[model samples]
Target: MPDTGRSERGAVSAARTRDFARFRHEALLLKALGISKPLIACMAQRAAVTGTSIETEVLASGAIDEEAYYGGLARMAGLPFVAEIPDGMINDGPALDCQLKEPTLVRLHCNGRAPVIALVPKITHIEGLASRVKRSACLGETIVITTPSAIRRAVWKAGGERRGRVAVHGLFQATQPLSARTVVTGDQGFSAGLLISGLLMLLALAPQLLMIILHLILSLFHLGGLMLRLAVLAHTRRHGSEHETMLQSADMALPIYSVMVAIYREAAVVPQLIAALDEIDWPRSRLDIKLVCEADDLETLAAIAKVRPGPHFEVVEVPAMQPRTKPKALTYALAGARGEFITIYDAEDRPHPQQLREAYHRFRLSSDKLACLQSPLVIANGGESWLSAVFALEYAALFRRLLPALGFYRMPLPLGGTSNHFRTAALTGCGG
Candidate 1:
C-alpha cells in the first residue's frame, strides 16, 4: 500500500512536468513565429505568474497588432478570419449584449441564420459571453476572428452612436449666450439706451448748447472711426501686391482642417455648397466638414441627406436656443469640431480651391500669436447689378485692405463672417 502511494505521487509529478513543458514549448513557438524575445518572455511570465494566456498578454500590451495575432489563431484553429463585419448585420439582440462587455475586442453577429461570435483570440473572459449568447440566441454560435476596429465599429452601431448623440456633452453650454457674447453684446444696447436718454435730457434743458455738443461728439466719433479705417486701408494697399508664400505639397500632411458651414433657409444652395466643399484642395480624409443646420430646418436636412457627403462630412443639428444668429449656429458646431485648424464658410459662397492649403501654409510660416487669417472675399454677382458692384468693392476694401492692415499693426482684426480661417486651439481658447 505504501509503494502504491509512492507510485501515485510519481505519476502526479510527471503530469505536472509535462504541463510546464507544454507552456515552455508554446512560448518558444511564439518566439519562433517572429514575436520579439522580450515580448515572448513577458507573455510566458504573464501566463505562468498571472495565469494570463500568451496571446492575451501580447494583444493587451499591443506588442503585436490584433489582425496578425487573431489571424494566426484563426488559421491554427481552422476558423474564418473576418477583418470587418458588414454594416446592419448585428442588431440589438442577445448577441449584441455579448459584445457590449468588451466592445473594442468582441462582436457578435448572424451568418446565414447561424449566430457567430467574432473575438480577438485568447480573450479568457469571452467564453462565458459566447455561452450566454448560445443559450439565449437559440442558434448555434460560431466563432470568427476580426480586427479591433471592426469590433468597435459593430459595438458603436449596436447602440454607442445613439448614446453619443444624447450625452449632452456640454457643447451648448460651453458656447452659451452666444448671441449676447458673440454677435450683439448686451452692454452695447444698454450703453446706446443710456446715451440716448442723456442726449434727450440735455436737449430739453438747453437746445442750442445741446445741438452744438451733439454735433461735436458725432463729428469726433465719425472722424476717429474713419481715420482708423483709412490707416488700415493705406497699410493694406502698401502690402497688397506682395507675393504670398507658395504652398508646398509636403506641407499638406501636417494639418487636419475643420470646415464649418452654417446653413439656414438655404436648402436650394446645398448642391452648390457641396460642390464648393468638394473643390477644396485639402485631403478629404483630413477634412472635418461640419454642415451646421437648425433643428427645425427639415428641408435643409433632407437636402444634405440627398447630397450624401463622405464620412468626413457631418451634419450638426443645432438645438433651438435664444438669439438664433449665424454666430450662434457656428458656436453650436464648434463644440464638435475635430481638427488642428478651423474655418467658416457661408452657404452661398464658393471659396478659392487653394484657399485651405494657402491658409495652412501661412499659419505654419507665421508667429505663434498669429491666430486668425481672413481670406479675400470677392462678389461673384458683381456684374449683375450696380448694388452688387458696390458690395463687391466694399468687401474688397474691408477684407483685402483693412483687415490685413489691422493684422500687420497688431490691432484687433474684426472677422469678415465668412472665409475666416483660425487655429482650432486659439479659437476654442477664446470661447469657441
Candidate 2:
C-alpha cells in the first residue's frame, strides 16, 4: 500500500502553499488598487491578532465601506457594480435562504437577459473572473458584482411573507409539546377536570376528611417548592458563581452574535432602546441586531427609521397575528436570525455592555448540554410601589440566585422570557 503518512503530509504542505499563494495574490491586487503598504501591514497584523481574515479586519475596522470595496472588486473583474438588488428582479425559492448566509450568487432577469449577480466568492477567483470577462464580452454583460447586504435585503423582501409564516408556526409545527400555543393537551385537560370534580364531590359528602386530605397534598407541594428554593440558596452562598469574572476575554475572532428586541406600542422609548443597543461592546460587522416590530406599529418603525441605526441593525416587521404577545413577536423574527448565537431583550432593558462578551465566554466553557445562559433580570421600578418591590425581590431570589443553583445541582431550570442567550443550532433543534 502507498505510504499514508507521507500522503497526509504532502496534502498538508500543498494546502499551506495554496494559502501562501492566495495571500500574496490578494496583497498584490490591493497594492495595485492604491492601498499603501503600511495600511496593508496594519490590517494584516490586526487580522493575525484577531485570528480573522484581512478582508474581515478591513471591513470591520471601517477602513473601507462595502460600497467602495465591492465596487473596486467589480472594476477589477470588469463586471458591472449594482448598488442595490431589486426585489422584483429576483425569484424566491425554498433554497434561496442559502444566499442569506453566504451570499455567493443571485440570478437576476433584466431587460430580457439573465444577468447573474455575485459577491466575490474568494479574492483568488477575481483574476480568473477578470480573464473570463476579457475573453468573452457576453460573459461580462451577464455578470455583475454587489455587496452582501444588498443580496440579503433582496432575499428578505422576496421572502417576507414566507419568513413570517415560518417564524409564527415553526415552533408549534416542529414540536407541539414545547409550544405554548395550546393551553393544555386534550388528555391533560380531561384529567385535570376529572380530579377537580372528584375533589368537590368528596367535599360535599365528607367535609372534614376532604379538608384534611386537601391540606396534606397542598402542604407537600408547598414544602417541595420551599426545599428547592433553600437548596439553591445554600448552594449559592457556599460556592458563588463560576462566571463571576465573565470567564476569559474573547480576543480571538468571534462568531456573529445576534441581539433581538421585540417591541409593541412603545414608540416613546425607541430612542433609549436604540441607544442601549448601540452601547453593547462587540465588533459592528459581527453584530446582527434585529428590532422586531408589529406590522401595524407604524410609529415605532418610523421612530427607528428616524434614528437610522447602523447597517448591522435591521427591522423585522412581523405581521399582526393572534396571540399578539412579546414571545410571539420574538418567535416570528427567529426565522430571519443570522447569527451563531442569539439573545432577546425587552424595549426598556439596558443590558450590561459586557453582557454579550460574558455570555459567549460561558458558552465556550460549557458543554453541549448547556442550551442557554439566562442573564439575571433585575426590576428597576421596585421603589415605585410596595407591590413592585415584592415583585423585584421575587425576581432577585429566583433569577440572580435560585436559577444558577438549580443548574449547578442538576435540577430542572426554567428560563425567563427575555435576556437569555442561546446557541442558534440548539435553539432551532428544539424548535425555537
Please write out the lDDT profile of model 1 over residues 306-389, one tens digit for every residue. 987765576776665555578767765665566789999999999998998888889888889888888888988999999999
Instruction: Write one digit per residue (lDDT tens) for candidate 2, span 130-234.
Output: 898899998776778888778877877777677667767877887778777889899999999999999899989999999899899999999998997788778
Estimate every model's Cα lDDT from 0 to 1: 0.70, 0.80
Instruction: Evaluate residue 354 in candidate 1 and report its C-alpha lDDT on the 0 to 100 scale.
Output: 90
**Candidate 2 residue runs with Cα over 4 Å from true position:** 1-42, 118-124, 207-216, 240-244, 319-323, 381-388
Q: In model 1, which residue pairs have backbone atoms overlapping below 3 Å?
A: none
The 10 consecutive residues of candidate 2 with the worst lDDT sum are 243-252
The candidate scoring highest on lDDT is 2
